[model samples]
Target chain A: MTLSKRIIPCLDVTDGRVVKGINFIDLQDAGDPVEIAKNYNEQGADEITFLDITASSDNRDLILDIIESVAKQIFIPLTVGGGVRSVNDVRRLLNAGADKVSINTSAILNPELVKESSARFGSQCIVVAIDAKRVDDHWEVFTHGGRNKTGLDALEWAKKMVDYGAGELLLTSMDRDGTKSGFDLELTQQISDAVEVPIIASGGVGNLKHLVDGVKLGKADAVLAASIFHFGEFSIKDAKEFMKNNNVEVRL
Target chain B: MIAIVDYGMGNLKSVHNAFKFIAPAIDSVVTSDPKVINNADRVVFPGQGAMPDCIREIEERNLKDAIIHAAQSKPFLGICIGLQLLFEKSDEGNIEGLKILKGNVCRFVSSKTEKIKIPHMGWNSVAHHGNHPLWANISNHEKFYFVHSYYVKEANSEIVQGQTEYGQKFTSAVAKDNLFACQFHPEKSGSAGLQLLKNFTSWTC
Candidate 1:
């Protein structure tokens, strides 16, 4: 009974504001990162992950201020990702009060970065984020915010990440990013089977049923969503209740 | 005041936050000092990550003696790896544990047909076993967040507060007089978790 289903709400921060949408388009400012995090905390979100999607791409100082603000205000665990390329970046983020640092593009480019950072900071602090999009009828890993295809199979990359010492896998389906259809069950199961660490299924979470399905069918340890949570499509309390009703274990 | 023993393993901030959320008036401090732990109203030992490192930290910081002393005096709560450390020993890294709970921690022996995964990581229902103040608000069959591979075995069954079945029934919560533990992250367990913390805060030992 050591396994627990995590309900994570992702905050896509750009220029210090929480922005979210499907396929990352027509983004609307949800609110201050700290404020929204507080709301999520009250709503019983198991954890909150802040994805600084624009920070590194724009070559700006990673929004330590926002992270610092949210860390100070929110009580739940905070995991920050995006543009974390080096061990130094990982150190900086952890020092900024992040409970965990998620590496995506950088880990794909340099798989050794995952091992190095995990060894230095311990694997529990390292989260390897895999952004996968269905290509040529196969799930292929993508990088650079889903703009660059690495031609690596999603399952193979996930196994490599675990070998490199990633404590957790944040698997996001790029094709389902904003679709609200549901999580890619096949992709989720593939990665979950490939790795021993906790797998957090992300993308295509439209409703509470989808979350239950992600955990039961996908065998995901946790479910991460962006647009649904950001736009107030469903509340964390409601989602947990729904999960419990469906016999999907959740913290009530 | 609740003394949260800090042995440099994982995040104590989330645990501190959870205590603050449930019992805002109950002061919580992360300290390695034996004197502070001895003087606190309650004690909480929360941990994450490997058992070997955590055990080394407890010894290095001289927290091992302090925690054992505090547990003898007041109600003590151990979360996740903290609970595993309460056992006599663990299969993880073949490390020695505090032996406070009169049990041993063993890895989940994955059956070939079951194909069950290790590091059981997710929410699972807890079946309450006995009367314990820490589980006042927590109902039977209520789910608690868990993330670990090894668990306590061969413990005094009377002290078992809750049990959960993954592949087989395992102790998810344990209580021995003033010493209490849960192999789940209550701070990360959401509202019900907060309520459990609140119950612990209000418990009169």
Candidate 2:
């Protein structure tokens, strides 16, 4: 069936609380990850992504509990990421109730991890989150939670990640993240067209209309945002209504 | 009692939790034992991952016969790979399937000039072909969460109970006698998903 463009509310968790910042820095407490995720579930969010921003920086056991609680209450799809290094980590997260497990630094560090995870858990459960920035006219990959810039090109990496068996790509614009300016249409569109896998456009979603633009212009299968849905600037329901009214198919 | 056939594939936790949430009184178990599956009041075969691995595990565990018996004898519900494996064979891994239904599974490719994403992952709507108890309380055009690249390309028309449009119209659900299988995941499909589980719990073949 022709799937509607998804509206995903992302919860960046650090120390078990959903945190937000400007461009992945200057962190501040937003709310309990489980509670906020439950709210989005009731509001008809298509999916929920929980990124343990400090997964590598601290103990990894913390987010598993949150994932368990959220997965129980939120019956939709739950994708958990950050600090995932191996297939064992993906197994532990899935056992804890995550429908999909996202890998970032590890996928970049060891692209074979993507192939391994996809083979073991199935490609449908593996997501490769790429944080990229526009350098001149080309997009370059970033690592360490979007702090360190990798010399790899964004489009080429996306294609490689897919070939390695990543079922979906969660592409974030490092430049526009938390800026709420809107998605990087050029970067998002470039990767979207290059890969056959579904692309979830994350970062820079200020208003409801930007969601429509992400699908209409960027060709993203889904649009993900942080501040807009987290702080109640726009409810997921409101965004779906706006998209439906604008002729962009969305779950209401 | 509902037995969720577990060959070490798919989201057994969510499927079990969904059943528990809908009908707390109903007993459910996710097991690989043929006896438990064959003895259950209802059977649900939920699957994910590659078809070849799923088939290998089923063969290694020797649960294929029990699954076939359940499908023929009781109310059976297959989800995603659970549904795909029922066909005769799949293009993926170029492997044989259960051969329960006369069909072939193949990957989704765009027929039009526009590009269509493989692994049609996300929420989408399904159009039911006929009225059935399993669809009880669920809207015909209800949206459900789906994540799959290969789908049943050919199957019996009488059994094709629902269809959905992606690159082109294709089968999304199937039903015959006591069997009901769908491409979308009901456990991950939110409220409508919960309702479908509830219907399955109370439904009598």
Candidate 3:
């Protein structure tokens, strides 16, 4: 009767293509967003998240087209993040078939967006993404894709976002972004404890044990990984199997 | 023909697309027109958002009578907020419901020690009651994607077909006559969900 700890495979897309160097040489078109998403779906990944790293508005239509095709084929839940700045962006993505819309910069620039959008579209569909990095004794919230610091405490910002009607929190550690070390367990645990809503630990997941530790130690409801899965280091099945063996319930 | 009643609540694309993926040849349309809902062989009332908002939109569009008629006559399927609306009333906004079933929708409560989160999101297993047609080919305790805060408390226990536990046991799915509803989204629940949707397409009850 317990809820399974989710294992989400995030696809970093730039110019309508997967940005990571995938080692799936067997895949004819490894960088294809739809193909990669479909591959993860078949691998039993709990959910598929698309982080649109494309900054140019000219390529917006490409992502939408990709989302439409993937949503048509994939039966599981789809989450879209990155460059989502307004309610209209959320609408466009959801209409294109995203189950949840994650907001990072917009939410920080205008905190009301989280409240207003969640009011119109249920809170269940509004995910507030917090990019934070440790600053001495406490963690500080960072924005602009973890490039700038906001001087705001990460824990305080998380609780405030929940109050502003964020259903879930996607907590990413800037320090661990491409380090391949593991998740910032202390940060994840603090956010999980600070708020009642579910929090997903992201940024540093080098191996299968990291996934288990993300849930077991960090108390995170889900774990989001990119390069490790993208580089063919390990499959989602291997991660879930390891988690299940370690007594962490997961959807096999 | 299947008419998915879309009353400007949430995205009906995934639900519509799931039907298209299952039986490509079938005529499935997302329509707000009550006439289309009435004429269709089957009706799917799928929605998400606040209960009060859902109620306002359904009434403003003059879909109240149409939805009630469809539920009474044909194989009507209610999903998420749709399922919550079928009950007598809801704790959310203290609003009235469709009253199609003898039940009430109540929010999940948490204590100091056990802080069960609201909007019970993510995958959880369902314990089916018996050999229901919807449960056909699906194993017992199969996991389905769910995301909601409030849950139904059906007065008639016999009508409760499926149950799931979060902080406590709640009715996840219910079936009575031609009416079938669930707290989880079968359209977004992957294979097991697709199987449930396929079952609904051929469901004669």
Q: What are the per-model C-alpha RMSD values against the true structure?
A: 3.8, 3.0, 1.0
Q: Compared with the true structure, what per-residue lDDT tens digits does model 2 show for residues A16-79?
A: 7777622322224236676677667888999998888764556568899898887776689999
Which one wins by lDDT: 2 or 3? 3
| B87-201: candidate 2 lDDT, tens digit per residue | 9999999999999999999988876687899989888899989888888999988999999999898798999988988887889999888899999999999999989888988
Superior candidate under TM-score, 2 versus 3: 3
Runs of candidate 3 with Cα error greater than 4 angstroms are none
Find the candidate with the highest TM-score and give its number: 3
True contacts kept of each: 0.39, 0.81, 0.79
CA-lDDT, candidates in order: 0.81, 0.88, 0.91
Every model's DockQ, to 2 decimals? Answer: 0.34, 0.75, 0.85
- In model 1, what lDDT does residue B152 have? 88
Clash number by candidate, in order: 11, 2, 0
Error of 1 at B187 (Å): 1.9
How do these models rank on TM-score, best leading?
3, 2, 1
Q: What is the lDDT of residue B79 in candidate 1?
A: 92
lDDT of 1: 0.81
Runs off by more than 4 Å, candidate 2 = A20-30, A55-58
